[model samples]
Structures are given as structure tokens and as C-alpha cells.
Target: MTEQEYFTVHHQLTINAEPLPEGSSLPSYPIFESEIPAPFIVASEFSHLDMLNDSARKELNNSDFKHVINLLDTQNSKLNLLLTFLLSQQDDPTYRTITSAFGASQCTFLSPTSLNDGQYVRIKLFLEHPAAAIYCYASVVECQAQEQGFDITVKYQLLRDADQDLLIKAALNQQQKLLRQRSLDRENNQ
Candidate 1:
């Protein structure tokens, strides 16, 4: 490896992954089992959802236990409708389990479709926290044809500081989970 490449640190993780939907078109059905599906939320839409979620949380923040259920019940339909509307706009989304090596600057994952060098991509993943989602833009660095389509590597282009921190935390957690799994396997074999 080149000196620069050798100096880069990466953490590997296996998760479901998916390509983003194209042209603002939503598939008729929901995307299931996606490892990471891009959320094509407009700024206004994001603001709306954020406000709604915040309001929802505030409603029950310190309410009496009896009122918590009532608050959720009152908002459930609106929240469901909003979520349903958002999901309807994504294109043919497919989720497949793939292993990836990711760092703050870049990520590598297997793709069922061939991607050209320098192609733009958006990578999204969620950590243990439901509210924590990683949404970053990237450019394809390499796309080598392997088994089905290509083994693609992408460099981050539009990663925010908050998103980068999220990635770092998720990567570390994934590494520890892998290590624990390996140790367990070794013990079982012995």
C-alpha cells in the first residue's frame, strides 16, 4: 500500500446497505430490510419532521404517567401519515447485507450495481440510537468488478462534523461487537 493509504485507519462492519432512490420518485411499496437507505428529505420536510418530533417529545417530556399514552395516541395517526408519505417517494430500494470498511473520510462496500470512478453517492446508516442517523455524501474512489457488480470505495465529500462523530462511534461499536463475537466463537470451539 502507498504511504498515505497505510496511514489511514478503518473499522469494518457488516450491515444491510442500499443505494439511494433516483429522481425523487417513490416506489409504490416500502423498502424492507435495508441496511442503509437514503432519506431524501427536503430542508423544509426535515424542518417539519424535526418540529413534529420535538413537539411529540415535549408533549410527554414530564407529563403524568397516565397522560403519556394519551399524548402518543393523539399524535400517532399524524406521525404515521407523515412517515408514510416520506416512504412513498423513494424508488426501488433494496437492502442487502454487506460488509464495509469505514472511517471518517471514506467507506467501502459491495454494490450490486457497477459504479464509475468519481461517481457521487450518499451513504446513510443508523446506530443504536433511533435518532442518530449518518447521512454523508461521497464520491466513488474505486469500483472493481468482483462477484456480481463491484466492490466500491467512496471518499466522503459532504460529511458534517456531527455525522462524522456518529460514524466514528458506530464504527467503534461495530468493531467491539465483532471482537466479542470472534472471542465467543473461539471459546465455543475450544
Candidate 2:
């Protein structure tokens, strides 16, 4: 698919926080709903329902939970960064399947949740597929609510060379289209 079809310049805003840390029971955060304008990088055009497991789906459906946010950053050749967000406490899983030209080594989760730095979360992904099933762990780093959804910034912690190569390929193919869409969005917003 063309990058334009996969990405938009618009932001989604919401408020809900759930904390799931390693070796600890899940904790619930108070649900706060609001809208905020934030920038995002769309990683794929695929739907969330396609890649998630049954448990993930149920967790994502909660009222405090919001939609997932995806972002892609292709800066390094060895690793491409894919960032995703679970906007609310509602339990609706986000899932996607990617075909990789290069294979991945490992995946890691970063920070869990934070109220500062504009609702940020970070996850490091490892790839293991030519057509592989990859599981990612994400920790919240910062969060805030606005007019659209929740504004967030996330860091990718663990990535391998194969993961990087696949991201580079996807980005190279989509860069032009993504740029065009960004331009269009700018004009519309003004």
C-alpha cells in the first residue's frame, strides 16, 4: 500500500492509564477523557484486530481504554523503530503482521506509564520472522489528554539488525507518499 493510504497527519486524543509491570500485578489508573493534538508516525495500514490474541482483545475493549497509536522511525540501518500506544484502560488489543525481508533477534519492553512528558511509552521490538509472529512489551513513559486523543512519546529499547533492515525497506517505499500526505494535512489544518 502507498504511504498516503497508510498514514495521516491527524492526531487522536484520549485519557486512560493502566500499569502492567514485570513480576507485579496489573494496576488501574483513574480514567480521564480529553482531547489533545499530537504528532504521530503511522507504521502500517493494517488493522489492530488482525494481530492481537484473545486476551489482548478483551483488555483493549475497556471504556477507559482508547485506540492504538502507531509510529515508525527509520534512522538507523541496523534497527527501525516501531512505536505503538494503548490509549485507554479499555481492553481492545492492537495487532499487526509484517513480512520481513530480514529476520529479528529479540524484543524488549521499556518504561510502563507516566503522566509527564505528554503521555509517553516506549517499547523495543525484536523481529524473528520472514513471516514471523512477534510479541512486543511496552511501558508508558509519558501521557496527556487533548482534543483528539492522548498525546504520547515512546522509546524503542531492544531491536536487531533484521528488524532495522525491514523498517528501512518499508520507510523507503513510503517516504514520498508520507511526505505528500503531511503536506496535504498542513494545508488543511491551516
Candidate 3:
């Protein structure tokens, strides 16, 4: 197994991990995928938001338009919140499993059943903060039995480049949030 090159965050997020049925074939990679999945559509919208932010930064290089950039930033935040609310309403609790830890390369979650090592599974990860989702394929790397159930870790096999970047950014953002909270706690204790 390749060493994890990216930082991981232990966070709770909705995910659906379904094992591939016997004799079933994996879906084509997103680039050649015929039917655009809902998660892919959502990811595309998030990418558009990222592109807009990048453009705004480039165009608003002068301090004179700092307020304009701030306004755009506020609008983006509102949009993300709205998207997140809408996505949550559509999420099916039956398929929801909270991820114990995740990074760009892989995610681990608790499951009721034992999944065989090297088993292929389809994954749909719903990210709340970024208001995005990822539809991809992964292979089960490890499954360890726990008191309640099994902790299954799957490595991404067919994730899009953009979706991977989103995961990386989300992990970094989560790390920053944790650091900030720790600093505040230390300051209060001192």
C-alpha cells in the first residue's frame, strides 16, 4: 500500500458504501461516464464556485475593490449554506454512515458487516461543509472487527481529480478548525 501523502481529518460525514455484487462490473471513470451522477453535478457546481473565487481574487488585486471581494465572499458562503441545507434534505438516512476519518486517498467508516479485503465498493460521500458530494469506486483495504461492528477502510479507485482536490481542501479546513478550537481552549485555561 502506498503511504498516505495527504493529511487526514477525523470527522463525521454522510457516506454510502455498497459492495459490488457478484459478476458486476465497475462503472466507467467519470470522464467517460455516460450518465452524469448527481454527486458529480454537485461537485461541478462547487468547482464553479471555486473558479469564481479565483477570478475574483485576480480581478480584485487592487485594494480599492476589497469591499467588492468581501461581498462576493459573503455571497459564496450563503450559497454554500443553502446548498448544504438542500442536500441534507435529500439525503437518505438508510444509506448514511458517518466516516471516522477521511483524506484525499481514502476514508474509513463503521459498518455492520465484514467486507472482504480487496473487495470493490461503490462510494458516495456527502460533504456538508463544502456543500458537495463525491461518487467514486474504492477497494476495501482493511476491515477490522470492533465491539459494535467493523471498521472498514477503502482506498479510492476511480475518483475524479477535482473531487480529490475538494477532499484535500476539506481536510485542511477541518484541521484548521480543530487547531483554532484547541488554541481557544488553551487560552481560556491559562
Better structure of 2 and 3 per lDDT: 3
- Which ten contiguous residues of candidate 2 have the minimum total lDDT? 32-41
Please write out the lDDT profile of model 1 over residues 60-81, one tens digit for every residue: 6668654765666577556545
lDDT of 2 at 32: 10
> Of the candidates shown, which would achieve the greatest TM-score relative to the real structure?
3
Writing each residue's lDDT as its tens digit, candidate 2 over 14-122 gives: 2122233434421222111011111111122121222343356466656445443111112221222222322111212341111111112211122232334322222
lDDT values, one for every candidate: 0.54, 0.29, 0.78
lDDT (C-alpha) at residue 182 in model 3: 98
Among all windows of ten consecutive residues in candidate 3, which has the lowest summed lDDT? 30-39
Model 1 ranges with Cα > 4 A deviation:
1-99, 128-131
Evaluated at residue 33, the lDDT of candidate 1 is 18
Q: Per-residue lDDT for 75 in model 2? A: 25
What TM-score against the true fold does each predicted structure earn? 0.50, 0.29, 0.81
